[model samples]
Target: MTIGSLLLGSTAALIAVSDARAVTTVAEPDPTEYAKICDVYGSGYVYISGTETCLRIGGYLSYYVGLGDVGLFYHARTSDVRTGEDQGTWQNNTRFTLKAWTGQETELGTLKTYTETRVNFGNRHTSVSDSSRSYAFNGDSILTFAWIQLGGLRVGKDWSAFDMFIGGAGDVLNQTPVPYGALDTNVVQYYFDAGNGFSAVVSLEEGSGVVGTIDNYAPQIVGGLKYTHGWGAITGVAGYDSNYESVAAKVRVDINVTNELLLFGMFGYGSNGKLNDDPMNAIDAHGRGFYKIWGGNWAFWAGAAYELNETTSLNLQLSGDQLKNYGVAANVAYALLPDFTVTAELDYDRYGGSAVGKVKASEVNWTNANKKSSVGGILRFERSF
Candidate 1:
């Protein structure tokens, strides 16, 4: 073969091979469609793709530690009492919460949904039934809030309206928890806005916990009325517990005396009807139900919060019940940074009634008949979005 012909053929063969080895290119997708801001509900919401529904996501993290005297947060575990083991007097906790929100407008009204899930890693409390186990959860993980609302009507799991309408007892870290009236329940509720400064709520609830939950199909009933103004507000709530055929009522007043100072007082009373004296604990001897959480037939709660400055605040709460149960709590909150906060609190409790345990009042650690009083303190650090 001729040199020129051989060179041309080789070059042609190389070109064909190069083309055959070339990588195939797949088709590219179209440009992404940006999400549209949805302002009808609130900030941080964006319209869902291909739909008008608004969606948002948020959460928080918290680290809390506490220590206290006997009968309060710190207690003598069954193991400690039986053996000479080290007393676990401190509680260390870490918690994570996830939340979601959605909103859509409809002919009926504004349709909205909210959900929250909480998980915690901590140590469980053991006054009589258990031994302290390290790194164990104090309580089961929970769906803290899950509810749907269409205008005035709402249904799902949430805090009872009796507490929501009456507001809680200031900002103090009340370790005992009942003074705030922050009880949880599944509810069917309706809200009414009567124009200027007046509103009302009607709720049918299924209570939580063993002693509070209904023993039958009959549901609990609650109603509330509230009036709001520039100088604070006045609110009242009443609940009928079907299980025990008992009734509870609360009245609250809030006075915003100054821009930086806020004060509130609440009084609760109940008819402990249909007493079941079978339980070892006498808490229900007078028929304590879900709505009547305090130790006795009547209880009073008062509290105040003062803004120390732009980044600091102080809070306090005092409460007492007809059964001679008393408690005091105080706290100071400081905003360490934008979305981070640090809070420290002190708590005191005295149980002068037979509501603490199955033991005699003189032998019960919660009773003044033996220990006089119990005290505790906690520190918390939180970050939220």
Candidate 2:
């Protein structure tokens, strides 16, 4: 054979061998990817793929039917806004709430964000017809609670620290006749844990409603302290209203009593003694200010809860203010399923003091001899997921 032909034959043989090897080679399978459950922050959390954060989604639906004079007096609308008129007798409301929480470990500490929103449908009976068939829908889609927290620092719309730190007791439909504080507001706050079951908090907030949004640089301030043990807890909170230049304070104690029973008591005091004069605009007499909300300068609340069994419980509460106004609430709650509950409650309230009486009459037209006294009841059902 010629030398050139021999070289061509050798090269062709090498090319054939390479092609055969390439055809026999197999590719390995890609690594399987799946969602991972996150138990660090508790149940219902799942880790986000390609991210360090974990997220949890939860929500609840509630329906309530109120009988007798259960609805708020302002719910009754009249042709004349100045004078009280009979409009509503019964009230009904349905609510749906959605919440989301995200958490991650960061250099600053455990970083977290929480958000909640609510939608409501309501109806009331009015004098305009045998029964007011009108129903209205409302929503707090604009973030009822949306906050970011790193370590102990938090900033956003949150429940007033003055009330949150101290907390409230009982599951009754009607809150204490004399309120200790208002609801959620814009806040910048910090929480401190001292270890050994002791902690503290300080917050700067923007007052809501007629108290007027903070027009000036001054913001409402709140401070609180709490001590908790295996059997009970003691808590105290104080607030300063910048607009009204007023101060309010609340102290509370909770006792486990027994594995199935709990007892609690609370007291509140406000610096605004003028609350009795103009009950509408007063800090304590009406829910006009951020913290102060009682008929007089001081108020008291006591309650108890007893679990009859794993599925049923009973609760009772009694409240009174320096103005002599008194209220009682009792309820029985039963769990129909793991995530569903039903509750029935009864309430009675009595007006006291001349100023408070007049204010009540102006709102509800309780001109009759027994107008100072009111009775109401509520039936509620809730499902959570």
The residue-by-residue lDDT of candidate 1 on 1-385, one tens digit each, is: 9999999999999998887767565556534544678999889898888887899989999988877642344342223556637565577778899999999999999899999999887775544335343445556689989999999999999999988878877786663533435378999999999999999999999988877777788988899999999999999999998877878999999999899999999999877666455565454664467787776567898889899899999999888876567788899999999789999988888766645322333454443454357777888899998
Measured by TM-score, how close is model 2 to the native structure? 0.80
Model 1 earns a TM-score of: 0.83
Report every candidate's CA lDDT: 0.78, 0.77
**Candidate 2 least-lDDT 10 residues:** 73-82
**Candidate 2 structure quality by residue, lDDT tens digits, 1-385:** 9999999999999999999999998877444433578899999998877788999999999998777654252132323334444344446678899999999999989999999988877764345543333344563454578988999999988888987788874666677555657667888999999999999999999968765456689998999999999999999999988876778899999999999999999998877533334555544345335677666567899999999999999999998876667888899999999899999998888876523422443354335344377788888899999
Which residue pairs come into collision in candidate 2?
284-294
Task: List TM-score per model, in order.
Answer: 0.83, 0.80
- Measured with C-alpha atoms, the lDDT of residue 283 in candidate 1 is 47
Candidate 2 wrong stretches, greater than 4 Å: 1-34, 71-88, 124-135, 138-142, 273-288, 353-371
